[model samples]
Target: MAESIIEQIRALEVLDSRGNPTVRVFVTLEDGTKASASVPSGASTGEHEAVELRDGDASRYGGKGVRKACANVNDIIAPELVGLDASEQAMIDRLMIELDATDNKSRLGANAILGVSMAVAKAAAQSRCDDLYRYVGGSEARRIPVPCMNILNGGEHADNSVDIQEFMAVPLGAPAFSEGLRYVAETFHTLKKILEKRGLATSVGDEGGFAPDLGSNEEAIELILEAIEKSGYEPGVDIAIALDSAATSFATDTIGLYDLKWSGAGRMRSDDLIEMAERWVEKYPIVLWEDPLGEEDWEGFVKFTKALGEKIEVVGDDLFVTNTKFIRRGIETGAANASLIKLNQIGTVTETVDAVRLCIENGWRAFLSHRSGETCDTFLADFAVAMGSGHLKTGSASRSERLAKYNRLLEIEDALDGNALYYWK
Candidate 1:
């Protein structure tokens, strides 16, 4: 076996789908194998998540530029990792973590560290002449995830009337990944026509979901149901509804109180929201609900999960932040049955995989995810298959950045031929 030694690491400032400057890292192995990875940003980020370093220079990119992070990759991380084996992902990540020294990676920036980490993994996979999924997950990595395609936008992802951040269509009934993608893609187009017929805006949000100012958050689900039926799919059987409340966006300082200002439903208690969720869950074919309560409202989460955990996937997004400590706490408390997993949320592939392991080991689901702002990089697509989490939520079907992952999955499914598994659970 040849050693894939890290030769050079460099980061370039690049624009994400949201037009914000992000870090794109390039890694060259000793054998001349080169690979690059892009770092994605989140609009509704967790308060306790690893901090992303920015230029803070208001003149460039509205103080959102990641030039400082890029510098950290080029000037600091490159020197120490040059001689190390790129295949030793955990060691490389640990060395970078020590260099950062901050608990949330505030110094060198998670963006900088993660970019290099991902690029190193890609370079190593290329050097090994293996797919990213095979390199990371071995021969057992053949399960294709059921994409929770967010076809409608609200909350932080859009300027709209709905309070819920995302309304996703889960194509769990499709036999293969390509057919499943086609099912949702056809539904997305049908949804567009329905919205147009209703004289609503056909414009898209950050995640490529429709951003029409609808009557109510519940109405958004109704519209999607119509689209699914119109597209010749049965709701809950062929496709199911998934919601991401992102309650922290509307959560007040008072732990249980929330200001649902987006939908003009102003100020409601956690109990009220929980009851509302119960009613909606019973009424709709909802299979998953994320961020039902605020990050700080742990008691509310426990209560909410108790009411609906057995029926649906009560996911912790901001609640866990892709950290094992928080995930462990949630597992102990039974706060959620699943968690949203993102590489950048935890700052390293090793840590992100650790989070997935922790969730699965606890008999909980690990739901792979993409940030609100993304890129055309298909690392996440391979990662979803690698993790074998069975489900993922990567934006809507419209945006090219979002479609990139879905398209990559199609390629992998084709390549896998008869071995790939596709399902919701």
Candidate 2:
């Protein structure tokens, strides 16, 4: 019999219990085969609404732009996917061009494109009885431990109403995942109460560490190290500690004044950043340091990465948008030992998968992640585990939304034969 013609495309709109909308897309094949993709619209902090993009702007949206693009993908591009071949990634990519050739579709475009890519890949993976990560080339036998988030309690980024530099104890080696989560919740609650008692906001800060004014970056680093030690995880061995400076270390004021905003500490001086990094390497068992310098400081990154070696795992999230071009740059400059993989960063399951492949093939590690402005989708946990990322970083075991990812991973383990040996305590 002749092959059936590709038939239909459909988009499903999903809203969180909070009523925030997310879009999912699916395409059908001639033989009744189907493929699908989806992404959640992440949250925003400090009045910066996450930007969404569409057909024309997928090429340029980076950082917060990616999240906005994801929203647009769900709202616009998903509907266009109806009545298309489930396997036609090339055709779809072409259609992306035709639909928004002006590339005006900012971050929203990347999100939409990525959503469709993920759905299509998932459908294909389902047909093979394999997980998405495994289908995309990640090994299934290993599961790396997830990292604990260090939240900013108060300081410069704080609305200035409170004493911010507080840290909580996360019982990392709890025998059960749920128990660990509970411990985290209890600890965070206690920390919050303490912050409140001191007239400080409990959940505010830049990069969730170091208040804007408590001291210099060196002082912030000392506090973080002390906090990690107190959190009860063995610094380097048990659950590894990591930093997410959020590009806060690399900003220049509007008129070219450097670092005037980071509590007058100014932008991170490359030498000072290197010094802090070296200190973390010794004082604390820091395994990961993300966005340590500004995105444009390629030379600084190269210098740090070359100096740190395997003593630490330098990761790039803002520096690369999970695109081949950025990955290639990292590879060329030796800027980092690992890369943060966020599907929405480049907008497609295939593209993101390709990025991971590039990393793994080139000896770089993968650290799949979640957005700070986030929802409760837990698919990423499964993806991270299945893909064999060196590790995952969602959030501390505090909010239900944050813990949901860890909970989902536990559930997946239960479904399997008590497997999931990669995580401990």
Candidate 3:
């Protein structure tokens, strides 16, 4: 019985490229039968402005320093798990912690180690004939509609200062992969044609010689609404719009000016944020919003959540950071109605699962998400559904990097008799 697990562990990390490096480790049973397992360096955030917040360096590896920190895990920790027991996941996880102990580095904080943990979990699931979501106990699966977050600055038809910081759009939750693909592609194509007719590229940033002027929030919203109506997603059913302001409201000099580093500006004023919330709800009909204010502004969030609980779901990404303390505080204070689950944010599969469970137990909506600066890993799709994430935020299914995750979810559904996921009660 354990031999099956051993073989599964051995098969981890079966894929790699210049952009990604993969490693396969077989956890051996006492009889020497190895479980197939493998680990691959997952996606990295590429050149994106949102990354500038961590430092001008692009890529998840660059801005957040995960690149430098996880680089060590590839060089060190991965080797320690070869020929280990995939079934004895606790042991493998223990090794990760022990390896990290040699130095004071946080095991989960190390991207390379976190990558290895993800691969390990994937293999472990295979041994059990379970998908990642099932393994994580996310039973009730629902495809929450996704909203588009347009990152544009003024130029051409758009302005340079992130014109419509966030927009709403949802992919049709088709029952078939081909249907989903065709729907998404045709929709984008049609959108391009219409925008072209209006002398616009239907783009967010500068492309070729044309740059879009996207500075005003009002203009941004109008363009987004127009795009939604044009794309035929308006009054969409079984779909919801999501938003990630990414602290732009505070990042601007006009409000909440603080010299504190990225980690410090958590406190936000209530009266101001509430006003913004009221204004946004009135204009956008947005169902999901992330990091609406500074992370530490607990009081402000409490007020906003109380006021907007029925109309929209206020989500916390930066606020939770995959840490239980922040999540507990949010729940206790009624600061947010949902939380975004990012594996790298906390650093390990077990920890990530724990966070999702905590969210479920607390009656908070769990949204599995990807970093803006992301690679082509498609694992989160399954994790989101299996973990009972009501929704997911990968990217527009257009970019291969983003599509990789979305497509993976479709594949999982295909394998499940077209009902591979169910919502958690």
lDDT of each: 0.93, 0.56, 0.53
Across 1-425, the per-residue lDDT of candidate 2 in tens digits comes to 31223355455555432344455667565566676555654332111121244224345332222334444454566567655654465566567646655433343454466556666656655655666545554555445344455554333334432222223233445554445555444444444454466554454443243233454444544444444445554434433445665443235532112253544554546766677678767876566677666666778788889888678778887687576788799998899888878766665555666788899899988778765434565667767767766467666555565567777776755655555554431
Of candidates 3 and 2, the better by lDDT = 2
Candidate 3: deviation at residue 218, Å? 2.8
Clashes of 1: 0
What are the candidates' C-alpha RMSDs?
Answer: 0.8, 6.3, 6.9
Which of the two candidates, 1 or 2, achieves a greater lDDT against the reference? 1
lDDT of 3 by residue, 156-195 (tens): 1133444223443444354444454444444445545655
Considering every candidate listed, which one attains the maximal lDDT?
A: 1
Ranking by lDDT: 1, 2, 3
- Residue runs of model 2 more than 4 Å from their true location after superposition: 1-51, 54-108, 122-145, 153-190, 193-199, 204-234, 237-239, 248-250, 253-260, 423-425
Q: What's the residue-level lDDT of 399 in candidate 2?
A: 54
Better of 1 and 3 by lDDT: 1
TM-score leader: 1
